[model samples]
Target: MECKATWRRWLLAALMAVSIVSYARPPASAGSDIADAAQAIHTHAGAHRLILLGELHGTREIPELVRLLATRYAAQGPVLLALEMPHREQASLNAYLSSNGDAHARATLRARALWQRADTDHDGRRSEEMLELIEAMRVLRGQGRDVAMLAYDTAADAPRNDANARDRFMAEVVRAAHGALPRGRLLVLGGNVHAMLERPGYAPPQMPVPMGAYLRDLQPVSVRIGAAAGEFWACRQPRPCGALAVDGSPGHTGPQPMPYTFGVMLERMSVARLIGRADDAENRRAVGP
Candidate 1:
């Protein structure tokens, strides 16, 4: 009886040890990659109050990257995540973020006009991944982190024909949002064009001054998202909008140019799932006979 009891005790201890080892193991390789990437970005972003992450919208990677960066920044101090959404949707965003993130909250958010556009060709801003990023931010806020989101783009009804005027308006909105969170780190995610600190040589003489140019005094670190090759959702004018192949061989390589402080090259770019279609379907279901 004594021998059997001793053996059982040993077996139990071994099982507990194995359990602890398994529990202490690091995340999977994919997670490790994300963590490493986030660390690299954080290291590069050292001491900069504003980080302008210029991305080719409609990619799954950029939104995930933003979420990872936001999580990292929120851990250190306050963080403001600014998106290229219309300024008018700010109220709905606030409500959704403050809510419990239940189905009802999500449905209410999906009902917004931004996600219910009649056009089939979306510009990739209204993506399911973007909505998920917002939900992730809400999760961070729920965890008591000082993370806030801002829709800094011009109102939906505002005239968008003038690129120069639009960029200037966007810059002004960002400035006000940053001012509100004076001490917090600001992360602005928008189109690569708007984040350019200087006009590229290829741009036309009348090309509008980029939004980043207006905020030059802030010394924002503009990081352009590059990719080797893959696909993304974009609307080529006059063409039906859909997943477009990215031919990254020509211009994706080489050293970083002026106006961009750094570059993050995604190994493989994938199209972000457009949420507008899904939202439209849902809306139809809600009102369907």
Candidate 2:
């Protein structure tokens, strides 16, 4: 009995140590508030309701958060996932999901090909695609709930280019799908930048404002918004290693912010300053013309 008590004490200490180490490591931003937000929205939104989960593309924790939240609410109803990916790839993803899918293959499909096909504006690229979608599908399937994909983007270059058309498309898609499923739940996973009140800068100047706001007005059921933003810290490793301030900005030195979901204003402004410096140098070097 003495030996058993000693072993239990040692085991408890080890477990506590492991937890402290885990918290010390970065990307642990899955706060209780975020989970509570998910639960609150889940409780309010009806089976036919729409919920948006926005993320700063490069943040790895966001997708994991999505998976966690989705699993937490899997018992609600059939989740119909609407993505920022192109409509063309939905069939491919559907086919892949229907097959005896491997994790590696699903990852490749979600990461590699989907964005390449989805980017209507060649200038706009996704830094880190929502690789969580595939994983979420796997989780839902495991729980015996149906998961479907809907691509909510058009071939147009900018949001302004297809404002009415896109709105109509969303309405029609929701109407059609909701009619069929007994308890259809709509969930849109997109870059936090795009689903904002105004379009991001890389998009055409004429891009309309209030894309997400307008959608909220249309839905009969309540809507919920949850977001996660990435702050750049001094990462010793190739991938980001730690978190900085709660709401800090990324760097804009020799390393350009990869054109992905949304361009950080601070990074962009810094790059402009560097470019001005370079131009000034060239002017000084130039001889009388």
Candidate 3:
């Protein structure tokens, strides 16, 4: 449960990535997959304080897996869900969760103009799969479960000017969440890069440290699980490559080229309803199964 060894951590992440990517089906294989994954998560999460789950935004499996973990852990004690969503949405989420209306949450997203990313790239800002996750969360809370969810991103009052600044701020927010609930287990979820134990910085002139690395530095008890399925978009872009493009040069994106399905990356929960019919069709054709 306690992943003190570097190799053990890597092995866990690799197994999750492999299983999540290769395993297929709707209701059958998911049981074993979820059971195996849930057991791993429970082992670490039960003993440790923080469990970071790496997500490939638009995929359906990752968030369902997260819900599986939350549902599994809710009976034992307090389970706090730390989301990568903007901290600004905290109040709206609270209101939406407290009420039965799903419409308000959708409206809040529209008011923020956080809907579609097609203006920059083909990546969806929101996805239906993610909405399902949000609905699941709301339902869990409504069922009188001890599952609490919130956005642990950025310093509530600070002005983030760069990516690193945002990472640090988000790290602080996570640490704050931990401090707030010392008795509960924290389930942190975010994109692959943000959740990596030894994550490198985003873009050039950035440090090699990831947000997870910062949290690990603060609390070494954290366990990070990375999951991805098939090929998906790598980041936000104006044009659709429908695949990966790596910078082979020194101090760049990668050591080699990796394939992808999205022109954009990391769609938010609202994306399921935020995007237009045309965009959804394009996304489904490009990546969705």
Candidate 4:
């Protein structure tokens, strides 16, 4: 009886050890994965001064990836992080980055029209994750890192339906930013289509020229984000904008080659939190009757 009890105690201890190891392994594995992905990004950034990351707008992963890359690049030298937001928001973005990332500064940034867009038009760019990314840049700058951000999209009042004109305008904005920071590295984040080096044969007539095509002379390394299956926020016209389901190797068009210089495959993706809605809810909760 004494021997049996001792054996049972040993077995229980081994089971608890296994349980502890299993629980601890996932977080470490996740960190490893992120580190590997960052290394891949670093390799690409090393070869090209301008790294264009074309991503699906509404995933939490891409923003985190951008933050990691920005942090790494800032350590080496000056770095510019450009986003697809309207140029009119540049003042607001600059102010937020310059200020202490406090509640008031966050509120001011959220007050912009981009974050308060109608639910039907909130296509994921104004995500909480993106806001967090901006905050991360602020933190980096506060830590004395030479980091800057640019809102390089077309102006809000510009003709929204003119794809080519919009791309040209965006490219010009990026060019000016690059010229201003000749020694600084730039990481331009935009929708996947805008990062294509050439217009795909299957592309619609509206986008005969992509922004990447316009900036090809700079030898920008364009990377397309890929996923096996996941959800992203997008509008399918006729359907309201919301989290949409994606399946079976999203972003891969077989036989016909894509214009991206390289690709980064994410294990899976999840929808990013909408910043406006979340902030509104938090405020309401704070002021409850």
Candidate 5:
């Protein structure tokens, strides 16, 4: 049964299980890359007048990038920092900032809201790690930019099993929010998973097809930023990583090259595992002593 709840409310509910650090991007540095990313995004915003910079959820550099851009873009107009975190965190989010407490506490309260309010199915239960991203969202919101949750989440029980639901959900938010945002620019922070073209493996094969192809169809302009080629892992774990290391986890890492699709990489991993299992039953065998 498809969830009867509205899309915005559903997004808030289902988003509770999200974790920011799982993708594990490298740390960003204080200079160069951060400035470059900021400058690039800034330039894009200035030129296109609207650009959504897709980011890995919980990447350490993302906050800094957001911090830089939010402040830089502050004068651009109402800079709506659209977060994938839930709406339940709003009150606590504001409180944490108002308390003038430390980063840990602020992060804690934000997570608490996500865990408590992730009952997207209206089942009256929270989700695991929903708080982490919520904490990140809180961090971004505390910055005092004109932020809002895009609320482009589909219900857990949606009729469509694919990410198109998510894409359409986001598109609707952009369209609706765009209506009131004159001279306003939207900066979406979300998992690249939902930002790509939903296909057979990544998305359910049976979902309704949209007119145009790819998630890019939903947005007019997008800018993907990260480390240069063969240098994504510039930072290491256990702190003191990257240019934007507030608490030391390296910034963006991986395939090294920026402007590539990590989401697609994840899908590739899924495919590889699937193929491995199909080719060799022993690979799928249960682990044993």
Candidate 6:
């Protein structure tokens, strides 16, 4: 049976698991080479329903690249900016974006946030990055883009406190988000772990396979990309600046971090023109049906 979109009331609560770090990405199982991750995705031509940008948070480059890709893709068809936000704030998030007033939006967003708490919990001053991401989506909306928000997370009545519980909740959220989209149009920004393909060959297991694995079960062709380079600050781990191993473990050795916008990495990666089709002209609204 196909699961449909559904919403339930949720109370605002808990600390966001916003652990920003440098993510490491191994080569995918198969795909044509492209200049950048965006170009790589464009090469797929929206053939897949879910495209996961597995990112290690705390860098400007990844989000900028995501904005560019999301903007370009929106012209193709309906695109959902399915963020890793707690599902409890769906109403507040919708209201924040829909409001034209800056003051009102800020107040509302601060009230029920997905990342930073409204008060002085953990650097409440820096919700700007997340808000900016929201604005990027809003800008596309103003220009008549088929963009929407999916606060897909563990909407637990009480704060979750276990690895198994968190992983299970995230899988459920990704499945729900995937089911809500049309066949091939979900652009997800998430932890690299969630974007990995399941490998049953391993002895025990991949130790808590992420949401992307669950999503892949539903949409086998989902694309995965990682936004990590060597030399990054780890907010939640002992290795503050180090290389990330293939399985998300941190190490002391790796190549230097690229300073530019995805720098020269696009050479090895797929790089395609921003516009996928001629019909993606600027005047076209292409809102979701």
For each candidate in turn, the TM-score is 0.81, 0.52, 0.65, 0.81, 0.50, 0.62
Overall local distance difference test of candidate 1: 0.71
Q: For residues 1-289, write the lDDT of model 2, one tens digit per residue.
A: 1133433332222112101101111223455645554555455544435555444433434454555556655566566666565554555555544544454454456454434422122222232314334545644564466565655554334355455556444434433444444564666665454444334467666454434544545453322132333342222334443333324332211112222212112211001101122243453233111
Point out where model 1 deviates above 4 Å: 1-35, 249-255, 278-289
Weakest ten-residue segment in model 6 by summed lDDT: 10-19
Model 2, runs deviating above 4 Å: 1-34, 44-48, 107-112, 116-129, 156-175, 192-205, 213-229, 232-289
Error of 6 at 20 (Å): 33
Model 3 agreement with the true structure over 1-289: per-residue lDDT tens digits = 1112432232222112101111122221344555565665576444676766655455455566777777777677777787776665566555555555345454564455344445334343255555556656667665666566666565334664565776765666676667666575788877656665564434345443467767765453333333222333445445552333322112221111211111111111112222433556675454334
Q: What are the runs in model 6 whose C-alpha is more than 4 Å off?
A: 1-35, 111-127, 155-162, 199-206, 220-233, 237-289
lDDT of 5 by residue, 1-289 (tens): 2232444343343223222222122223445566556765565445444455554432334455665666566555455555554433444544543343454554456345243321121111121122233333444444544443353334434465553565565556554445445565666665443333333344445444321123344344444444322212112334432223122112342222222222111110001111111222342232111
Ten-residue region with minimum lDDT total, candidate 2: 267-276
Which candidate number would show the highest TM-score if scored against the true structure? 4
Which lDDT value does model 4 have at 174? 73
Give candidate 3's error at residue 10 in angstroms: 33
Q: Cα lDDT for residue 217, model 2?
A: 50
What lDDT does each candidate get? 0.71, 0.42, 0.51, 0.71, 0.40, 0.47
Model 4 C-alpha lDDT per residue in residues 1-289, reported as the tens digit of each score: 1133433332222112101101111111234444556677687557578988888888878888888888888888888888998766777877777776666777788888788776767788877778878877777777677777887786667766755788887787777666666576888999988989899888866655989999999988888776667888877678988887755433442212458877766767788776555454764454232
Provide the lDDT at 76 for model 1: 88
On TM-score, the stronger of 1 and 6 is: 1
Q: Can you tell me which runs of candidate 4 are displaced by over 4 Å?
A: 1-31, 247-258, 277-289
The candidate with the higher lDDT, 1 or 2, is 1
Tens digits of per-residue lDDT, candidate 6, 1-289, equal 1123343222111111121222122211222222255564566544766666655543334555667678778888777776766666666666654555255565566545344322212311123445566766666666666677777665535454555566566667665656656443777776655555553344245256555555555653334343223322123334342223322222211222211011113212211111122332331232111
Instruction: Rank the candidate models, highest TM-score first.
Output: 4, 1, 3, 6, 2, 5
